[model samples]
Each structure stands twice: as C-alpha cells, then as structure tokens.
Target: MSRITLELAKKMIENAEKEANQIGVPMVICVVDEGGNFIACHRMDDAFLVSVDIAQNKAWTAAAMKMSTADLARVAGPGQELYGINTTNNGRIVVFGGGIPLRKIGQIAGAVGVSGGSVEQDVQVAQAAVKIFEDFE
Candidate 1:
C-alpha cells in the first residue's frame, strides 16, 4: 500500500499506546498521511491536553518534511541550515523527537507522532509505531 490505511494507523496508535503504558507516561499519539493530513489520533487517559495539537503537528511535520523530527532537530538548531524552520509553515513544524515517517518499499507512506512525555519516552512510543509499520505484511 502506497498510502496509510486506517487499519495501519490504528495499529500504529495501538503499538504506541502499549509503549507509553510500559514507559509509564500518558501520551497523545497521532498519524498522518503523506500529504500531512490527519488519519488517526489517540489521547491516553491523563495525557496533557496541549499534546493533542502537538502530536498532530509532529505527524504533519514528519510527513510534510519526509523525515523524522529527531533528525530535523539537528539541522534546525541555532545557526543551522534549517534554523527558524519551526517559525515558518505557520508554526506547524516540530523540531524534536517523536515524529517519524513510515516508509513502505523505500517510499514515505505516512508518519507517526507521540507526545505528552519526555523526548525519550515520546521517541520510544513513536518508534514502537514504526516497528509495527515495518513488521506489517
């Protein structure tokens, strides 16, 4: 499948939620298509309300930029090539961890984002979602 299906999005969220629970952090998980359109989102119990928008923005940033936000963060730092990029795109771009593109056959299919935790925890959850995507048949 070239695009993210609802089934895959839901699976990604499920895997992310499982990771969040294991990490003992409530999270807001989001999935988006290649065009940066929302596919699915989940707010765990006790998750920060503000994470709702952040999670989706992370997903959008990943899909639109076609790279993980963690990688983007490196180039987006002060005096870097993409410095101030977050200020552009109407402030929708996130320059940190927890946003990852889902690739199928070396093509970007969609993305997953997780928030409401520390950067490490969020990245763990997003990585879990990517694991599901990679393991899909």
Candidate 2:
C-alpha cells in the first residue's frame, strides 16, 4: 500500500486551515500514515497549544483503529475497556470528533485530524479534508 504523499498532506492541511479560518476557528491539523505515524502537522497562529496533542491523538486514533474517532467514541463507551485502552495508549489514543480515516480506492491510506475548536467545528474541518481524499480521482 502506498503511503500518503507529502503533497497530499500539504493540501489537506491547507484546505483544513482555510476552512477553519473561514469558520472563524483557529485549529491545528495533523495527518498520519496508515501506521499512525505523523506525516505532517500545522497549527494556525492563534490555535490553542493544547490542540497539538489533540490533533495528533485524533489522527493516531483513526489510523490505529481504522475508524473515525467519533465512531470509536460512540462504541468505546465509558467502561473498563475504554479505560484500559486509554491507559494502554498512555493517552495517545483519543476518541473524539475531528479525526477521520483517509481512503484511496476504498482502502484506508491514512488519517486526518483537526483540533483547537469545538467538536462540531473540528469535525467539519476534518470532514472537509477527508472528503478531498474520498473525492480524489
């Protein structure tokens, strides 16, 4: 499986940043490989510092789990298993909105994440980025 290209990562971050700015939300966007390793990250000037980890975790969760962070949150629930996972990951894995799997030809290629905004706003930015991959010809 081919890794996500740097050009694609740049485009994803640029598009997500633009969308976040248009919506009046500063954000940190991150992209990761299928193995959940960082490909690239960008933080808007006004984005919160905490957004860095949030964005990274979001991407990591999506790549590691092969599912959207939002979906994982829904299924993980508040329980022993979820708690264990959190502990196992040492806080690297996050179940939240803002993270989405990146697919190419219907296979997961990587993931994108956005942070430093409300969950809905983050989701919107990440969704837009993911859509770019999905709609790529």
Candidate 3:
C-alpha cells in the first residue's frame, strides 16, 4: 500500500489552517504516517503551546488504531469495549474528536490531527484536512 506523501501532508495542514482561520481559532495540526510516525506538523500563530503534543498524540492515536479518535472515544468510555485502552499506550492515545485516519485508494495511509480549540472546533479543522486527502489525485 502506498503511504501518504509529504506533499499531501503539507496540503492537509494548509487546508486545516484555512479552516481554523475561517473559524477564528488558531490551531496546531499534525500528520502521522501509517505506522504512526510523525510526518509533519503546523502551529498557527497564537495557538497554545500545549496543543503541539496534543495534536501529535491525536494523529498517532488515529494512525495506530486505524480509526478516528472520535470513534475511539465512543468505545473507550467506562463500561465500553475499549475501556482504559488509552492508558495502555503510555498515555499517548487520545480518545476524542479531532483525529482522523487518511485513506488512499481505499487503504489507511496515515492520519491528521488538530488542536488549540474546543473538541468540536478541533474536529472541524481535522475534517477539513481530511477533505484534502479525500480529494487527492
């Protein structure tokens, strides 16, 4: 399977930044390869410093798990199937919105994450980035 290219990762970040700007929220965006390795990251002006780590971990979680962090959140809660799973990955797993796996030719290629806003806002930015991946040539 082909992995996400560096060019695509950058495009994802650019689209994410545009969405964040449109919403008036500075953001930290991260991309990870299929193996959960860091590919690229961007911190918008005025974004919180803490968002850097959050965004990276979110991308890692999505790539490693091969699922959106939002979907993971549903099953990671108390009494759910993946309960306490987040604590197993040295606390790097993020069980929330704002992380999504990127697919290429029907295969998971990588993931993108966004932070520096509310969960909903972050999710919006992340979704915008994923749209770039979806439309990639």
Q: Rate the local accuracy (lDDT) of all candidates.
A: 0.92, 0.86, 0.93
lDDT (Cα, tens digit) per residue for candidate 1, span 46-80:
99999999999999999899999999999999999
Cα lDDT tens digits, model 2, 22-103, are 9999899999988888999999998999999999999989988889988888867776356446555787878778899887
Off by over 4 Å in 1: none
Model 3 ranges off by over 4 Å? none
Off by over 4 Å in 2: 79-84
Lowest lDDT sum, 10 consecutive residues, model 1, at: 1-10
lDDT of 2: 0.86
Instruction: Work out how many backbone clashes candidate 3 has.
Output: 0
TM-score of each: 0.97, 0.91, 0.96
Q: Pick the candidate with the highest TM-score.
A: 1
Clashing pairs in 1: none
Model 2 clash count equals 0
On TM-score, the stronger of 1 and 2 is 1
**Separate clash counts for every candidate:** 0, 0, 0
RMSD of each candidate? Answer: 0.9, 1.7, 1.0
